[model samples]
Structure formats: structure tokens, C-alpha cells
Target: MRAAVYIRVSTDDQVKHGYSLAEQREACCSRARILGAQEVTVFSDEGISGSTLERPGLNEMREAAREGRFQLLVVRDPDRLSRKLAHQLLITDELEKCGIKLEFLDFDWKDTPEGRLFYSIRGAIAEYEREKIRDRMGRGKEQKARQGGIPINFDVFGYQYDPETGKVSYLEHEKKVVVEIFNWFTSEDIGANGIAKRLNENGIPTRRRAGRWHRQVVKQILANTVYIGLWRFKGMYIKVPPIIDENTFYRAQEKLKEVRRLYAGKQKHGYLLSGLITCADCGNTMTGAYARWWGKRERRYTCNKTCQGYKNEGCRPVKYILADALEEAVWNQIQTWLMDPDRLAREAMGQIVGQNDPREQIMVINKHLASIEKGQEALIDVIAKGYLDHMDSIEKKLAELKRRKEKLEKRKEELLLAYRQREELFAKIDEIREISESILRRLDDLAFTEKRSLVRALVKQVIVSGRGVPGGNGLRFINVTVLAKIPEQKISS
Candidate 1:
């Protein structure tokens, strides 16, 4: 009979209880040999958490057992098998299915009923330990949350709060990204799907830490009051770090509340462009309103302005587009944009071409730094030669040169950071292009106001100036201003 020995030692086990790897391996191997086994194969899971099913060595041993490489399996104790009862039961069922007899050096399951009971009790004790540990960790997190520090389940982005020290710190670049999303959604009146599609197109990772972004993530970002300095823990407000200004945040919330009110008690109201359309004439946003007519669904973008003073004032006629037709037009535009892949690639490459070479810039700055040092030394030398008449001028010149040198060195560092970002973007150029094409394709499939939402993502503002297109009847020229890539600016309020 061939025997396989499995051993596991967690970080906590090694430190607190001294469950050393060498001792476990020695005991398991000795016991397997003593059990009249012809061959012994040892499997060790070191520095692995027993709570998770990611143990490498344990997986290999289980595979070997299934292949009939070992007829008997030995462990130092039942705890070595697993810390969780459910996991232990699963392992036992798998071993049984493979017709492999599991053995514990401290347990004699095949010998007597008393031994079986002892093994069961030992497994229970291990399970209790794991539960205790889990409970302690959960309690610690709850305590931190109660003390005005956000509980760290890690879903919240933009800023990280250390529960131990209660020190809230922001990842500068990531925070800016979040702010951009918020601004794009509310101010630009972009829908959740459109925002998510644009973000995915720009190679932004999704909320699930997966390869793609989802509309739900966009919704969460829009509804998250935490960005404006309100921290929520388990659905209750706790601690927060101020990100956006209070006024802007309140306005965003107000818009969100209005959107919710508009869609209340209606099924199928969660359309892509539900909350983003604005009135071109009255300057009020067009809220989504629907009515059943002749057993057919009719959707209209109604201006929030109730007074119709301009109705008879000979103003530009309000053009109300059918939701479906609007969505179709937007989709057609997206399809046209993505059909030429070569153009998109060229456009992407053009953005990074004029960036300064960080290495050359650093070298130039270093030369200036050396010259400053030399100038300081020369000034000291002249002062030491008893020529103190122009000493003050020389000193001032040296100070100015030193400051300029410092500024250049700092600028070089900034250039290095920009270069690193360009390098990363270049590496993912192909992936970025593919993502962009996919986003355009997806946007082209949305209906009505949904299409308008896709437009809102790329556009900052759409001003309808009550001006009609040339040679067209009452068709107003919609002036669209796009929100292209811009250098990040720090916003402190």
C-alpha cells in the first residue's frame, strides 16, 4: 500500500502554537512508514490559510490521490486536514469517492469506535478555533466602524482609510478619476450605461476587479454620497473624508433624488437615458414621461417648465424626438466611429507623441544642478579672497541659481511620472483600442434617450441656441462641446 502524507502550517499556527513544518513532515512520514506502507509521498502546505481552498500542495496531493498514486493518506492531526468543518467534510467525501483511506497519526479510525469519536471531537475543536478567529476579526472591523473609521471590505474606491490609525488618505490619481466620473454623470447628464461604457473604453477596471465595467457600478458611483465626505458603514453614516465640495455634492444628490421620483412606481423605467435629457428651449431638463395610447407605448422627453409663455411668443418650436428614433440615431453614429479601426489607432497614438523624454530632461536638469553647485563654490572662493564688495550680489545670484536648479529637478521628476504613464498606456494600446471599439458597438445598440446618454458621456454640454440648421425646417443646431482628455487639476474645498 502506498501512503501520502499531507501537512499544513498557517502563519498564526507557526507563531503562536509552534506548528513547525519540519516537525509535521517528520511525524507524518514516520507514521506512514510504521503503518506498513511500501512508498511514502509527502505534501506540504506552508504559509497557507486553511480557511480558503487555495492551498497549492494540498491540491496536488488530492489530485495524486484521485489518480490512485496513494492508497492511504496520513496527516499529523485532523486539524492538518482542515480548520473548517464543511471543508473537512468535503475533503473526506472527495477522498472517499477516490476510494483512498484517510489516516491521521493521532487518530485510528479503522481500529475502534472510541478512536472515531476522538477524531470527530478533534475536528470539532479545529472548527471552533476557526470560528473564533473569524468572529474576532469581524468584531474588530465592527469596532473600527463604530469609532468613525470605514470598515474595510474594500468596495469603496477613491480613498483608503486605515482602521487602526483612523488615517484617511486619498490615491490622488484614482480620486481624480472618481471626481471625473461624478462630474461627467450629473453635470453632463450621462446615463449609467454610457458612463460605464466610456470608462471601459478608457481601460478602466470595473467595480468587480474584472476586465470590464458594468452599468451597476456606474449607478453606485453616482449614488455614493461618500465621495462628498459622508462615510457609510453597513447602511449607516459613520466617518468620511471630504472629496468634492458640499454644494456640488448636494446638487448631485438632488438630481439623483429627482430621477428616482420620476421613475417611481413604474416598471421598465430604468432606461439608459432616463435621467439625462435636458430641454433645449426652456433650459430645464427634460424628464422622462410615458403614456399608453391606442394600446401602444409612447415615450416623450417633457420640459420641466410648466408655464407656456413661449408657446404663443413665436419662439423656436420645441422638437420632441421619439425615444426609439433618438436611440437609433446615436447608435448609428457610434457604429460609424468604430468602423475605421486604423483611424482610432492613429488618434490614440497622436496623444502621446509630443511628450518630453524624461531621461533627457533629467540629464539636462542634472547639468543645471551641477552648474549651481559650481557657482556656489566659486562665490565662496571669491569671498575668501577678501573681495567682499560684490559678495552680496554673488550670494544673491547663487541663491537664485539654487532655486532655479531645485525647480528644474522637481520638473524632471514630474516628467518622469508622465513618461511612466505614457509607457503604461503604450503597452496597453491594442487592448485600449479594442475596448474603445467595443464601447462604441455597445452604445449603438441602446434605444432612444439611451443614445442621447452615450453622447452625453463624450460631451460636457449640449446647448440648443434656438437656431435652426441651414435649409432645414425648425431643426435646431445642437451645439455639442466634448469633454476630451485634460491634465488633472487638484480640487480642494
Candidate 2:
């Protein structure tokens, strides 16, 4: 007869409760020896959680059982098999299906109905007890928070947390950096990346003292309201030492919003009518093209078919419109609309045509996503509190919550995209009348980059008609039309 012994101990179980694999092996092997086993094999998983089915030693034991390498298996206790009740029953069923006998020193193994009932009840009680323990630990943190205490040790860059006292204190060096980041974001024309680079050049150490300062870390510092004395903990904002004033923090937030609304992370190209021109003859969107002829470098808008890597199945006679002529025409048209707010409002009001508002559906998705995030935070809170003894169950719960969150977030993005253009158009209309009044006074005086941004904000696309007839002199323009976005207020607030 061949026999197998399985033993397991998580990191916490070994350190806190003194559960050792060597001790379990000593006892399980002795039990196997008494069972008249000629050959015995021992499988052990150390520092790995039993709440999951992905243990190395446990997998080897299951495989050995299936291959008939062991006709009998001995475990010190059912908890050694798995902390999860579902996994315990699954492994037990799998072993029985393979015709292997499972024997636990602390548990009876019988094929009778009463034995199965008692095993399932005991597994349920163990699982319930584990949950109660984690719940108690989580509740303790909440109770501490309710009593006006700082329970967690993770402080932001500008603050230091003492675990012994659970009190947060300001670190002078890091607080100065945090103040500088906020000042740069609010008062200077520099972006987050520029600030991060400046910090790295100054040899600034990160909060962890691990590596160079990251743009995300800088952004987080600027965005955190804790700099103004409000720290978010378990959905509650506790008071912390203020690193910066409220006005500076709010200004930084506004600047962040303005940056996102304008550039949206994409670098601006030099073309004025980029991604906004259509070839009327071939129904192809025109693209900007730059070419040097002799001593002259010229920019023009041409049909997509004329570009390299694209098949030349374009109009019978493809025409290239000079960038200067097309831009001047479009800019003049935009200046006219901006100068006349009424016409701009009328034209742009119904321009963006979408089926549903999507705001209601988006609100629903946001609520669902919030619920999923709350569940994830609760699980993380327990794990973060050093509850690694039952970490497998928490990990499983976190994974499930994250999967649901990703699905909801994906749906929210789709809905947001569907409503982006229309909402932005209407939103622009709401503020355009006053903005255009000021902007029109200096429209032509705007720089090339500013002009491109203005053109992108106002104009949707340009459609030019007729092809250039190869005349005696050169290619000549036939006609040009500008479709400027004049979003009007259609829906009520």
C-alpha cells in the first residue's frame, strides 16, 4: 500500500500560531506508518494561503492521487487541506472520485450520509469563524476612526505616520516638496511631467526612498485634499495637517481640469485644418501634407489616397489645396461666427445628434462601480491590517470585485464617449457667447498654437468642391466650405 501526507502553513500561521510543516509531517507520517503503508510520500506548502486552490504542494498531491501514486492520504486536519469550505469539499470529492482514501488526524473520514453532513457543517463553521475574525479586525479600524483616531499607517509624501502612536506628523523636507508641486501646478505654466523632471533634477527622494519621482506621484500630491487638512479614510475624511491653503489646492484642481479639457494628453500638430477636411469628389477625409519644391517648402491639404501606403483609388483628378488658402478661409469663417454669437448658437445647437442623453445610464454605472470599489476597499483594508492568515479568501473576494468593477468602468467609458461630443458642444455654447466676445478682439493676433486650438474648438470639418484643372499656370482652387461647430442649447439643465 502507498500513502501520502499533506501539510500546509501560511506565513501568519507559522509566525503567530507556531504551526510548522515539520511538526505536521512528523505526526502525519506516524499515522501513515500505523496504517500498514509500505511506501509513503509527503507534500507540503509553506507560506502559501490555503484559501486558494493554486498551491504548489497541494496540486502535486492532487495529481499524485489521480495517478494512483497514493491509495491513502493523511492530513493533520481539514484546515491543512484548505481554509475555504468550497475548496475543502472539492478536493475531498476529487480524491474520492480517484478512489483514494482521505484520512485526517483531527477529522473522521466516512462515506456515510451523517459523516458528510457533519463535515460540511464543520467546514461552514470554520469559514464563518474566519469571516468573524476579519470582520472584527475591520470593525476595530472603523471604531478607531469613529473615535477620531488615525488607524492606518500609510501617509502621503508630505506626512509621516507613527504606527506605535497612530498619529500623523508633518515631515518638513517632504512637505516643502509638496508645497512646491502645488505652486508649480497652480501658478506656473509647467505640467506634471515638467514638475516631476524638476524634482528628479534636484535629487529629490521619493516617499519610499526607492527610485526617481514619478509624474503620477506628483499629480497625486497635487490632487490630494489632505494637503488642505482632509484625509480620506474608509470613506471618511479625517483632519490632517495642512500642507497648502485651500485656495491654492482648488486653483490646482481647476488648472488640472483646464489642461485635460484643452489638450487631452495629445500633442498639437501644426496643421490648422487637421482631421477636419473632406475631399468632396472621392468622399475621403483630407490630411495635411508637407513638401519641399526647389527652394520653397509648402504645406497643403490632400486626399487620403495620395498619401503613401494607401491605394490611389481616389477622384479622377486629385486636387491639393494650399494650407495657407484653406486655413485663411476657415479662420475668416470662424471669426465671422465668433463675432456673431446668435448665428453660432443657432448652427451649433442641433449639430451634435445622438439618440439618448446617456447621462442617466452613466449615473447608474457610476453607482454600481462605486459599490464594487467599496467592496474592494473593505477586502484590502483587512489584508493591509496584516490578516494574511485568511488572505486567500480576501484575495478571492477582491478579484471578483475588480472583475465587476472593470466591466462597469468599460461600460461607463462607452457611454461617456457616446455623449462626449454633444455634451461638449452644448457646454461650449453655454460659455461661448462671452468667451467669443473677448476672443474675437484678438483672434488674428493669437499665436500659431493658440490659433490651432481655437480652430479645433470651433470648427468640425471643411468640405472643398471640384478638382484642380491642370491649367496653363498651375493648380487653382474651385470652392471651399467650412462646417464650424455652433453648438446651441437644446437640452435644459
Candidate 3:
């Protein structure tokens, strides 16, 4: 007789109960030998959970069993196969189909109805125990966060943790690197790639001593607020010693956001108005591309309906507009706006005042919702008073009420979100107004990304009209319409 012994132990099981894979393997092997099996194979999965059947050893054992390599499969306990009842039955059924008998050294009641019920109960209890342990650990961590205590398994770069005192202190050398990264990004306007290249060129080691510096690593270091003495854990912020000042941190954040917005999509050609430009014909946003025209590479913008998944259902224009001419025209118009600070300020202030108050609308919706709830309660009372004949009509009215309630609830959420965004929107308008002069002075000296950011902040959309034939000296009939970022107000009729 040939026999295969399987053993498994999870990390938590090993830590809590001192259960060893070796112990299970030895017991199963002894049982196999006592059953008079001459050839025995051992399969063991260590530090792997029994809730899944993806274990390497278990898979190999199943393959061998299917090959008729063993007459019997031996495990120390039923759970050594799987902690799930469904998985246990599945594995056992698969082995039985392959003409291999399963033998559990701890129990021989697998064939009985009572044993199957007991096995299912045990599996359920094991799963419940794992869930309870996970929940308890989560609650403990959240409690520690609320109490301002350091998390047990917390690990972050640029800081050293003292386990005994539960204190995190700045690593002096790493702290200097962090400050330098921020300064290069915010003050010098160096991008993440350039910063990473500089760090690697200087032979500076990453947090993991041997790891190479990466652009993503530099970006993460720049984005982390931990250097500003705040440890954010489970929605709680714990105060620590500061390494970077608030002003530098916030400026870096603003620069990052500006860069993200400027080059949001595929702007590989670095088109000035890639995301901001829209085709007046198809109403679809234009995408930047390079096309060869008469043996010359020409950068152009075209309606991106095909790329946007519209396929054959979009406007196909005869000719694409030159990128340089369109961008130059838009830039001149922005320059005109920048030259008039008074007009720009007045227009921005007008938009701000014209914006509707979302709070008032929310109050009105709430009042209507209260009335609906009262009507629903009255209908329920009428139905409860043995009004069985009105049940069908009442149900129809109730469903309609529910639909309206849902519609109003969704509207309320939208209004609330807009209300929350109102402050930030107004602040942006104010900042644009305040910096109008400074921006005009540096308009010519600004970098490509900076110019793009300025244009995106000030202009809502650039509607390009009329297509021109390629190979021409310039656009024959290029008309660019610039829409300023003005808030639209509802007109009372």
C-alpha cells in the first residue's frame, strides 16, 4: 500500500498554540507506517492559511493522487486539508474520484452523518475565530490611534521608531534629504524625475540601503505630510516633531496639483491646450497628434471621437488644424486678458457673487422630504387600520414616494458636495485675481508647464472654429473663442 501524508500550519496557529508542521507531519507519517504502507510520500504547507486550496504542496499532492501514485491520503486532522467545509468536501471528493482514500489520524468519523455535521461546525468556528481575531486587531489599532499611541507595526521612511518608548524620531540624514527634495520640487520647480536623477547621481542611498532611487519614491516623499510632524493613522492625526514647515509643504502640494491638472491625459507631444481645447464641430475634446503631410511632420489637433469610443458615430472633418497657430492665437487672447487686471478682477468677482447658494436649496429639499415622510406615515396608519381594499393603490403610492425620496436624497448629496467645494472655488478665484499682475510680468518667462497651468486656471475652454487645408503657410480662417472661467447663475423668469 502507498500513502501520502499532508500537514499544514498557519502563522497565527503556530504563534498562539505552538502548533508545528513538523509535529503534524511526524504523526501522520507514523500513522501511515502503522497502517502498513510500504511507500509513503509527505506533503507539508507551512506558514500558509488553510482557508484557501492554493497551497503548492496540496496541489502537488492532488496531482500525484490523480496519477495513481498513492492508495491513501493521510492528514493529522481534517482541517489540515482545509479550514472551509466546502473546500474540505471538494478535496475529499476529488481524491475519492481519483481512487485515493482519505485517512485522518485524529478522527475516523468522516464517513458518518454526525461526523459531517461536526466537521462543518468546526470549520464554521475556525472561520469565525479568524474573523474575530481580525476585527479585534482592527479595533485595537483604531483605539491606539485615538489614544495618540504609536501603531505596533508602523514603518515609514525618513524616521526612526523606538519600540520600547513608542516614539518616532527623525533620522537626521534622511530628514535633510526630505527637506532638500521638497525645496528642489517647490522652490526650484524640479520635477520628480529630475529630483530622482539628482539623488541617484549623488550616490544617496534609499530607505532600503541597497535599493535604487526611483521617481515614484521621490514623489511619495514629497507628498507625505509625516515630515511636518503629523502621523495620520485611521483618521486620527498624531503630532510629532516637525521637519518641513507648513508653507513649503502646502506650496509643494499646490505645484503637484497644478502639474497633475496641466498634463492630465495623453499629452506626449506637450500640446499647450491638449485637455482644454474642444472641437466646435463634434463637441468632443481635441487630442494632440503628429501627422506627416507632404513629407513633413506636422503637429495637429483633431476631434478624438474614435479614440473616445464613438467609432463611426462622430464628425469626421476634412482637415486638421495646426497646433502652433491655434496655441499662439489662444496665448495672445490670454495675454490680452492678463493686461487688463481691473476687468479680470471685476469679472471674477461678478462670477463669485452670481454663484447660487446651495445651502438654501438644501433646506427647501429637506422640508419637502419631511412632508413626504409624514405622508408615508399617515398612509401606513391608514393601511394598518384594516384598510385591505386600498392595499394595491397604497403600494403604488408608496413605491412612487420611495422613488421621489431617492431622487431628492441624491440631489441633496450633490448639493452638499457643491456646498463643500464652494469655499475652495471662491479661494481659487481670489488667488487668480491677486496674482494677475505677477503672472503677466512672468508670462513670457514661465516654463511650458507653468504656462499650461496658468491657461487652465484662467480659461474654461478654447473652442476652435473652421478647419484649414494642410500645407498652407498658415490657417486660412482660424477663429478661436476663449471662454473665461465664469460661474453661471440661474436667471429668475
Candidate 4:
């Protein structure tokens, strides 16, 4: 007789229930030999839960059983096959259909009604235990979150977690990268795809040590509020040390929303200036669209609201501009700017110095914060002194004060962060000069995506007007507005 022994042990089972994979394999093999089976095969799924049949070993065993490789299937118990009653019955029925008899070493229960009932009861108990374990773990996590502690055993990109102390701290190097990501997205006009490309070009590894960065990964980082000192878990927010200022984070979010609105369904064309271009006449975003011209399909940027939909009724005579000509015109201007390091430095420094000083504002915030703290203390004193008549009003006032204090503190942090970022930018002006020189020297050698990133970093908007040849060099108007720091240039072709 040919027999196949199957065993499985989840991680929890190995730790708490003492059900090691080796032990289960040994017991099943012993039972297979006792059944007088000559050619026995053993299939084991280690650290695999019995709730799912997706285990490699289990699938292989099922395939072999269907091929009539074994006359009997042996397991330590029915729950070893599956903790779910339905799965156990289905697996047994499958084996029976393959002309294989199912045998349990720990019990002989499948044939008789009482035995089947006992098997089902054990399976029910196993499933119930799993649910209870999950419930307990969820409760534990909720408790930890309520206490403002790191609950999950996972690491965030720019933060380090201490499992023993349940404390989280910023990883300085990674935090700098996080801040740079926000700065590029919000200030440099680089979208998530551009950021991901830049990270990959710079050989920056992801949080998981992945060799490449994807657009989705960059998007997740931009959308995560954790960098702003708020950890959202199961609808609860816990405060942490913020990596990026709240202002920058929210600004990035607004940019993301704008990008979504502009390039909502036009990703397939891979337009270079999809979200960055605006129709000069309509004052609406110009989207990438195709038109039939001279019996050929030509790709062009057009104001969709003016051309297709009636959303912008004020727009008359819809505008369509050649995609390639506008992209090239903008790219050429950006390359020219990159080649001039002195101009770049002057413009960047000017913007940095033009920022408003936040010290006075921060001082005022501190005064209000102090007042709020005193008010909270006074409210607590009143409550402690058995003044129950106006308890509700007192509590409401305290809550309002606390909310105001939080806002003021958040504003102060933003101001301080902005100041620090300016100082850092001033210090790194020389490094920026060198990097721009390198990029300018190798401008033509960069890939299309890399060129797109460079253009997005330097140019804020590429306003297009009038029609031009689809693949030709002539365009009616192309205005390349460089970033706020740099002087805007209008190129007419």
C-alpha cells in the first residue's frame, strides 16, 4: 500500500501548542508505517496556517493524490488538515473522489456519526481559538494606541522603533530624506513619479531595502500623515515627533489632489506636461488629448472642459497645442537655466531671504499657549473645588483652550521648520551649484523620465496657446514659468 503523510504547524501552534513541524511529521510517518504502507511520501507545510489551502506542500500533495500517487492520506488529526469544518470536509471529499482513504493517527472519527461530531467540535474549537487570539491581539493594539505607544511590530520609513520600550525615534538620515521628499513635491513642483525617478537615479534604497523606487511608494510617502507627527491607526491619531512640518505636509497633499484632478485618467499617454500645463485663454488645465488631423492621429494638449465637456462655458474657441514642441521648448529653457549656476544661486538665495520672519509670530503663539495652559489649570482647580454647577461649561472651555493651544503649537513648529529649512538651503547653495552644473553637462544624456523630472523641478508651469504642427518645431506661444525663485521666461516659436 502507498501512503502520503501531511503535516502543518503555524507559528503560534509551534510556540504555544508545542506542535512542532518535526514532531507532527514524525508522528504521521510513524502512523503511516504502522498502517503497513510500503512506499510512503511525507508532505509538510511549516509555519503555515491551516485556515487556507494555499500552502505549497498542501497543493503538491493534492496534485499527487489526484494522480493516484497514494492509496491513503494520513494526518495527526482532522484539524491538521484544516481548522475550518468546511475545509476539512472538502479536503476529505476530494481525497475520497481520488480513490484515497483518509486516516487520522490521533483519532478514528470520520466514519461514525458520533466520531464525525467530535471531529467537527474540535475543528470549531480550533477556529474559535484563532478568533479569540485575533480579538485579544486587536484589543492589545488598541490599548497601546490609546496610550500613545507604537503598537505594530513594523518599522516606518524614517523612524526607528524600540520594541522593548515601545518608543519611536527619528532616524536622522532617513528623516532628512523624508523632508527632502516633501520639499521636492511641494516646492520644486515634482510629482510622485518624478520623485521616484529621482530617488532611483540617486541610488537611494527604499525602506525595505528594495533596490528601486516605484511611483506608488513615493505616493504613499506623500500621503502618509505620519511624517507630520500624527500616526493614524484604526481611526485613532497618536502624536509623534514630526519629520516634515505640518504646513509642508498639507501643501504636498493639496498638490497631490491637484495632480489627481488634472491627470485623473490620462496616465496611459505618459504626457510630459499633463498636470503642469494650463490653457492661457480658458484659465483651465490643458489635458493630453488626441485629434484627427490631415487623416492622421495627432497627440496634442487641449482644454478638455472647453472642447469635450461644457463645464467651462466661458471658454470659447478651444485651444490645442502640439505636445512635442511645447515639451522641447520648455526643456531647452530649463537646460539653459541649469547651465548658468550664478543665476540659479542668485534666484534661489533671493527666494530663501524673501520668506517672512516667524519669530514674532512664534512669540505671540507662545504667549497664547501660556494663557491656555493657565486657563486649563484654573479649570482643573475649579473642578477639584467641587464647583459642579458650571462643570459642563468649564469642561467645554477647557477643551476649546486645548484645541487652540494645539493649533498654535502646530503653527509654531511650522514656522521653526521653515526657518531651519531656509538656513539649510543657504548653507547648501554651493552643493546645489555643483549638482546643477553636473545635470546641465549631462542634460542630453538623461532618459525621458529623468528629463521630465528635471523640467518639473525647475519649471512651475508651461502655458500653451494656439495650434501647431503635431511633430513639427513651430508653435504659436510657449511660456515657461520657472519656479518662483527664478525669473519667468516666455519663448515664442
Each model's total of backbone clashes = 3, 4, 0, 0
Q: What TM-score number comes out for model 3?
A: 0.54
* Model 3 lDDT tens row, 1-493: 8999998898988888777988887888898989889999998899898889899999999888766788888897777898877898798778866667778887764657897788778777877886898899889888877888886655777788898888888888988999899999998857887888788779988887885677778778878888788878767898778889999999999998887887675355688887887777767678787877678888887774432113333455444778887787777777877787666756666765667799999999999999999989989998889788979899889867866876787699999998888777667766766688788877789999998898887778887766765454456665667787753211110
- Better candidate number, 2 or 3, judged by TM-score: 3
Write down the lDDT that model 4 would get: 0.78
Runs of candidate 1 with Cα error greater than 4 angstroms are 18-23, 44-48, 52-68, 86-102, 105-110, 150-155, 162-164, 197-214, 260-493
User: Candidate 1: lDDT of 329?
Assistant: 38
Candidate with the larger TM-score of 1 and 4: 4
lDDT of each: 0.66, 0.79, 0.79, 0.78
Models sorted by lDDT, best on top: 2, 3, 4, 1
- Residue 227 Cα positional deviation in candidate 4, in Å, after optimal superposition: 1.0
Cα RMSD to native, each candidate?
26.0, 19.9, 20.3, 29.1
Model 1, position 375, has a per-residue lDDT of 84
Between candidates 1 and 2, the one scoring higher on lDDT is: 2
Tens digit per residue, CA lDDT, model 1, 357-422: 677887887888888889888888898898989877987887577557656765877988888887
Index of the highest-TM-score prediction: 3
Off by over 4 Å in 2: 15-17, 264-493
At residue 242, give the lDDT of candidate 3.
Answer: 81
The list of candidate 4 runs beyond 4 A from truth reads 260-493
